[model samples]
Target: MTDSIVRVAGLTKKFGAFTAIDDVSFTVERNKIYGLLGRNGAGKTTLMQLLTGQQFATSGTLEVFGASPVENARVLQSLCFIKESQKYPDSFRPDHVLASAPWFFAHWDAAFAARLVDDFRLPLNRPIKKLSRGQLSAVGVIVELASRAPLTFFDEPYLGLDAVARQIFYDRLLEDYAEHPRTIILSTHLIDEVSNLLEHVLVIDEGRILIDQDAEQLRGSASTVVGKKTDVDAFVAGRDIISRTGIGGLASVTVAGLSAAERAAARATGLELSPVSLQQLIVQRTTSDTAESETVTTTDAWSARS
Candidate 1:
């Protein structure tokens, strides 16, 4: 079995009365791409900061590569964290950043970095402060892909890039990852775009982990059952329904944990079973009417039946 590269148990971080991360726990396996997904202000960035040792936890433990990452150069050396709002000295040019990268990343690929620079069309001589937002993002992407760090964290690395540029970044990342396997945690809001690239997914909602599971397993975990009102209601009875909708005499319900026999039974009843997109599932799981209420509430009727 592959070893766990990152482990967290009961990790929590607070600021004054506000908790940024609340009793979160999960493990990241080696050489896999994980999507750290959530809505805005959902503590995704805070959690990434904790994992990378940029911020300390208020309570509980965090282990990266079997050791605490805090003030440990050895642990930090194996990581490359690229954030959306990365900053550089006003006087420094794009070439200066590339020149300094080799000193930090032991496995820096100068040739690959050069190629990426050309591909992104970054102006090496222009001062970084004067570059467009997209160009700055390109600089970060180039360094991250060329660094070949054992574990990399990209927190919305494609923030300012257009569709074409984003595709370039994704293509390059996939190509490099294929050749050199490494652990990657990508925290982004673009769920559907990167859905296929993820092996696992970690979703945070209101400073808590709402979902942590294999990507493929999650894809099949929830489905929408649609048909006549009576048929759909009967088929989804005693099932965990996350959301429901109706039009005229028909009803569609989003449900979880349906087995083959159960699905076959639904099909037998003339109900249409449609796959739920990852984005749709997540949005449903995180939406709530009250701030205190947890997202994705199961049906009380289903519980009683079970």
Candidate 2:
């Protein structure tokens, strides 16, 4: 049986002339990591805000923890949202923020937070306003991890952290989650970096849910075929084509899943099949038609390789 902690139906958020999160709906299960992915201005942030009750929805229904999240202390208590530009008190220091986290998060882990502070090399005494962009981001990362909320939202949480610091966050998150499982929703532009960490993915494009599926399933859901233009056309005739490009006699086409027999058939026909990465697949799925227009053809594709 599926355990859904969050449920939304026909949810929509509009801002006068613009529709930020247009009619969208999906479910979030317990004890899993979800990636809310999309291109810039695709309404990723807007959706997160609506879920966290930072903004009221223009229409539709959404429930968190079996109740509306808007101004509900009970529901809000179980959520910790960490964003890139997370603000702090004017005079607050890294130590101050960590010191006060427990007041807001019932499950806040001081010891774990301290360990993360050291791991990120965050200065305790320095005022937040004086910290570098990376150091500031670390402060938020520390709190979100240590909060241990039942449902945590990390919205571009590692904005300025260097590669090493980011890795530390990922490693610690996975390690801690193993010991204390909880539902986590992560929204970021670094798809490839967090791709492996994601168990499930919810891709938003143009304020609508574009792709919702298991990360593992998405890994081998698409394949690119390369060979002669005429041969490629014949092979992918009725198949879902994602994007296609050609020069002279050579052509490259991406298409949806193909059965083992189909793959063998393509190989026999002298066609080269390559697996599409999660990032590449989402890019192909959400890439604007104007941009893909330069590629030559259209349809859409997914690979059956696991």
Candidate 3:
């Protein structure tokens, strides 16, 4: 609802005979950190490419900064895209990249970049190609944070980073973002790690937008109930079940949208209530979708044979 920095409508992208990004539509509001989440080969990268003008969409409209992003200088100027596999010139060093960053990013901060370099312990004089994978990822993280672009996309930016280094990236990101508010889209497999940093979440499954909701709302949207199999099943009879598993007479069920009374009733009935994390919820949802799709395909094949 707030002023959106990116507006997409019926967007689709394909490669020869394969569709990468299916018809997806969503809005990315300004000054918020969004988690672009999904499994591998789920079109998260393709969607980002389309938004950043790295690849043309096969169909539908995508607007960045209220205009077409493809070759639009005005829109491109305010964007910075950092990725795990980012390449640099063979002759370039950390210092050289830092020196040239200002030319590309109007809001580049040299002082901040220097601080980040120290934080990540990057060697300024060493050739980029010689740096270790963690060090290389650090360089990209430094540029992304220092760029201060109005719209930034980080696609798997911490591939080779250690836990400590990844924490540093998160800390620096939060600190810098507080001082300089900007819209950031983070794409990564480390869902639980950055779950706290996200304000909104956009989950894509099989090239389609699956979940678009506020992080806080999603946090409390579902609860896991564990009890006797029959009792648990009865309690969740009409509820939107995200997932359900049973062992002998005991059953554990994850249901969506339980009211205060419902929770109290479950507790009174000796059913244990537990919170469901965002990562768990998404996994369950996507897995359920996949299973359903497979089932439908099998059914169609069987009907044809019959």
Candidate 4:
């Protein structure tokens, strides 16, 4: 079994009367990429902060590298957290940020950092405060990738990046990770884009863990069944239905925990079956009731076009 790099039990973080992270518990394994997924205000950032020692949990135990990360130099040294809204000194230039990175990360690679600077076309001499949003994001990506820390947390690192730049980041990350394996937790809203790169997924909704499982297993855990309304309803009866839509005499319902045999049986009954994308499944699971109702209306409209 892979070693657990980070562990939490009954972790909770609250601000006044509001609970940002409510009694969360999970283990992050070594040498795997984990996707920290959630909608806005879902406490994904708060959880990252707790794990990285930037914030103290209100209750429960938290451990990183087998010790409390709070003020622990050894545990802090193994961490590299890059945030979407990262801030740097007003007087600092891009080159200054790159130059100072070595002090924090013992495994920092100057050569790799320089290569990434060139790759992103970042102006090293330009003052960071004057750089555009995309350029600022590139700087963070460069540091996190070149740091090569044992445990890296990238919280929506591609906020202002364009399609090409985001692809570059993903490609470089995959390439480097293959050569130097480590634990990486990427928190992002771009679920489908990075779904293939994730080994494990942890979803947060309303300050709670809604889903935690292997990425491959999650993909196969839910399926969409479509056919005559009566037949589809029968197949989905008593099953865990995530969402459903229908138009005229036809219907489509996404159901969870349908085994391979169950899927084959649906096909045998002349019902069409399709796989649900990771993004679709997560959205359905985490969206609010009002948003889900809106989705159902939208789905019905789309089904009418078919």
Q: Give one digit per residue, the lDDT tens place, for model 2 in 79-98.
A: 99976778788999999999
Q: Which is superior by TM-score, 3 or 4? A: 4
TM-score of each candidate? 0.91, 0.91, 0.91, 0.94
Q: Candidate 4: where are CA atoms >4 Å away?
A: 293-306
Per-residue accuracy of model 4 over 63-122 as CA lDDT, tens digit each = 999999999999999999977788888899999999999999999999999988888999
lDDT of each: 0.89, 0.90, 0.89, 0.91
The window of 10 residues in a row where model 1 has the poorest summed lDDT is: 297-306
In model 2, the worst 10-residue window by lDDT is 297-306
Best by lDDT: 4
**Candidate 4: C-alpha lDDT:** 0.91
Model 3 TM-score is 0.91
Cα RMSD of all models vs. native, in order, equals: 5.9, 4.2, 6.9, 3.0
lDDT-superior candidate, 1 or 4: 4
Model 4 residue 128 CA deviation in Å: 1.2
